[model samples]
Target chain A: MKNFMALISGILFSLGLGLSGMMDPKKVLGFLDVTRTWDPSLAFVMGGALVITVVTFRFILKRKAPVCEQNFALPTAKDITSRLVIGSALFGIGWGLAGLCPGPAIANIFTGNVQMILFVAIMVVSMIITEKLVD
Target chain B: MTISSEFTPLLSLSGGIVIGLATTLFLLFLGKIAGISGIVRGLLTGKKQDRSWRSFFIGGMVLGGLLISFLKPELTAKVYEFDTFKLIAAALFVGVGTTLGSGCTSGHGICGLSRFSKRSIVATITFMAFGMLTVFVMGA
Candidate 1:
C-alpha cells in the first residue's frame, strides 16, 4: 500500500512539473538567469507549493505518526556547514548550466531524449562515486 | 542576455499547488519527503526494505513522463540543447553536489523550505545565489 501510494505521489508530482513548465530546460534557465531573460514563473511555482505545505506540514507533523510509517523520516541536522554551502553552490552552477534538476530529470526519463538519458546515466555514476569518496 | 517574453503565472502556480498536494500525500501517509534525489540515492544505497517504495515511486515518475508525452507532447519535448562536455559536467556537479549537500530542488527547495529548517534555508539561498551567478557568468 505504501509503495502504491508512492507511485501515485510520483505521478502527481511529475504532472505538476509538466503543467508548471518545469519540464523545459529553457524555461528553468529563464528563471535561473535573473540577470537576463528573467522569468518569474518558477518563483510562483515555489510560492504555490509553499502556501500549501507551510500550513499543512505544521498540522500533519503534530500527529503522532503518519498513516503508513511509524515515524516521519525528517532531517535533524541544523548546523550550516561548509559542505552544505560548497555542494549547493556546485549544484546551482550545474542547474544554471543545464537547467535540469534531479526530479525533473528522472521524471522525463521515458521521453527517449538521448541527451537526458546521458545526463541521468552520468549523474547516477557521479552520485555513486561521491557516496563512496565523500563522508 | 535578453528578457524572455514567456512568463507564465497561472499555469505555474496551479502546477506548483499540485506538486505540493503530492508532497502532502506522501507526508500524510508514507512519511516521506518526496525528494527525488534522496529517493534515488536511497534506492541506490539504502537498506533492502527501503528499496521497494523508492523503486515504485521512480517507476511512477517514468510512467508519468510517458503519460505527459502523450497528453502534452509539447511539454515533453526537449527545448534546449547542450554539448556532451557541458552535459556531463552539469550532471556530475548535480549528482555529487546533491549527495554532499544532502538534498536537491525538491527536497531542500520545497520540503525543507516549507518546514523552515535553518539548514534548508541556508542551502536554498546558497544554491539560488550560485545559480543566478553562474548564469550571469556564463551568459547562458
Candidate 2:
C-alpha cells in the first residue's frame, strides 16, 4: 500500500518537473542566472508549490500519523554545521554547471541522455564516498 | 501571471502545483519526505523496510518520464547537449556536495524550507548563493 502511494507520488512529482520545464538544464540555468538571462519561471514554480505545501503540511502536522505509516519520519538535526555549508556550496556549484539536481536527473533518466547517465553515476559514487568518510 | 519571454508561466505554475500535490501525498500517506537524495541514501543505509518504497518511488520517476515522452511526444522535445569534460566535473561536485551537505535542491530547497527547519533554511541560502556565484564566476 505504501509502495503504491510512493510510486504515485513519484510519478506526479516527475510530471510536474517535466511539464514546468524544471527538467530542462537550460531552464534551470536560466533561473539561476539572475545576472544574465534570469528566467523567473522557476520562481513561479517554487511559489506555486509552496502555496500548496504551506497550506497542506500544516493540516498534516495536526494529524496523529500518516495513512500508511505509524509515525512521521522527519529530519531531526537542527544545527547549522560546517558540513552543511561546504557541502551545499559545492552542490550549488555543480547545480550551476549542469542545472541537473538529483530529482530532475532521475526524472529525466528515461531520455537516455549520456550526460545524465554520467552525471548520476558520478553522483552515486560521490554519495557512497560521503557515506564511508564523512561523519 | 507575468510569463517570462522565454518560458511559459501558466505551465510552470501548473507543474509546480502538481509537484506540490505529489509531495503532499507523500507527507499525508507515506509520512515521508519526497526528497530524492535522502530516498536514495536511505536505500543504502536504512533498515530493510525502507529500501523497497524508495526503489518503487524512483522506478515511478523513470517510468513516468518514459510515459510522458511516449504519450505527449512534444514534451520530450530535444535532449540537452553536454560537453563531456564539464559534465564530468559537474557530476563529481554534485556527488560530494549533496552527500556532505545531507540534501539537495529538492530536499533542502523545497521540503526543508517548507518545514521551516532552521538548518534547511541555512543550507538553502548557502546553495542558492553558491549556485548563482558559480554561474557568475564561470560565466557559463
Candidate 3:
C-alpha cells in the first residue's frame, strides 16, 4: 500500500511540474530573467502552490498524527550556521544558472529534453562526488 | 474565466490539485512524507529497508510526466536551452549544499516548516536568502 501510494504521488508531482510549465527550462529561465522577457507566470505557480499547501496543511495537522505514518519526521535543528548559509547560497546559484532544480529536472525527463538529461547526469555525478568527499 | 493563453489558470489549479492529492495520498497510504530529498538520500546511502519507498516515490514522479504527456503533447514538447558546464557546476553545488543542510527545499522548506520545525524554518530562510543573493550577484 505504501509503495503504491508513493508511486502515485510521484506521478502526480511530475504532472504538476508539467502543467505548471516547470518542466520547461525556458519558463523557469523567464522567471529568473527579471529585466528582459521576464515571465511572472512562475510566481503564479508558486502562489497557487502556497495557497493550496497552507489550506491543506491546516486540515492535515488537525489530526493527532498522520493516517499512514506513525509520526511526522520533523527536523530538529535550528541554527543559522555557516553550513546553512553556504548550502542555500549554492542552491540559489544553481537554480539561477541552470534554471532547473532537482524536482523539475527529474520531471523534465518525460519530455525527453536532452538538456535535462545532462543536468540530471551531472546532478547524480555531483551527488556521488560530494558523498565521497564528505565521508 | 475566459482563457486568454494556452497556459490557463484551470491548468494550474488542476495541476496543483493533483499534486496536493498525490501528496496527501502518499502520507495517508504510504506512511511517508512526499519529500524527494529523503527518498533520494535514502537511495544513495544504501538504506536497503528504505529502498521501496524511494523507488516508488521516484517511479511516481516519472509516471506523472508520462501521464501529462499523453494529455498535452504539445505543451510537453516545449524547448529550452542549457549550458552544460554551468548546469554541472550548479548540480554539484546543490548536491553538496543539500547534504550539508540535511534537507532540500521540499524536505526542509515544504514538509518540515509546515510542521513548524525550527530547523526547517532556518533552512528555508537560508535557502530563500541565498537564492535572492545569488540572483542579485548573477544579475538574473
Every model's TM-score on chain B: 0.92, 0.86, 0.78
Q: Compare the candidates by DockQ and give the number of the best one.
A: 1
lDDT of 3 by residue, B9-115 (tens): 56655555556566666655554556665567667775687788788788778777667667765455335545567767777777777766666656665566556
- Pairwise DockQ winner, candidates 1 and 2: 1
CA shift of B120, model 1, Å: 0.5
Off by over 4 Å in 1: B1-5, B77-79
Q: What do the candidate models score in CA lDDT, each in turn? A: 0.86, 0.82, 0.65
In order of TM-score, best first, we have 1, 2, 3
**Residue-wise C-alpha lDDT for candidate 3, range A95-116, written one tens digit per residue:** 6766666777776665656766
Per-prediction interface RMSD in Å: 1.3, 2.5, 4.0
Query: Which candidate number would show the highest TM-score if scored against the true structure?
Result: 1
Model 2 chain A weakest lDDT span, ten residues long: A108-117
Worst 10 residues of 3 chain A by lDDT: A42-51
* Candidate 1, A1-135: lDDT as tens digits: 899999999899999888888888777888988776788898988988999999989999999999999999888888999999998998998888788889889877778677898899888888888988985
Q: After superposition, how far is residue A110 of candidate 3 from its true place, in Å?
A: 4.0
How much of the true contact map at the interface does candidate 3 reproduce, as a fraction?
A: 0.49
Fnat, one value per model:
0.78, 0.76, 0.49
Clashing pairs in model 2, backbone N/Cα/C closer than 3 A: none
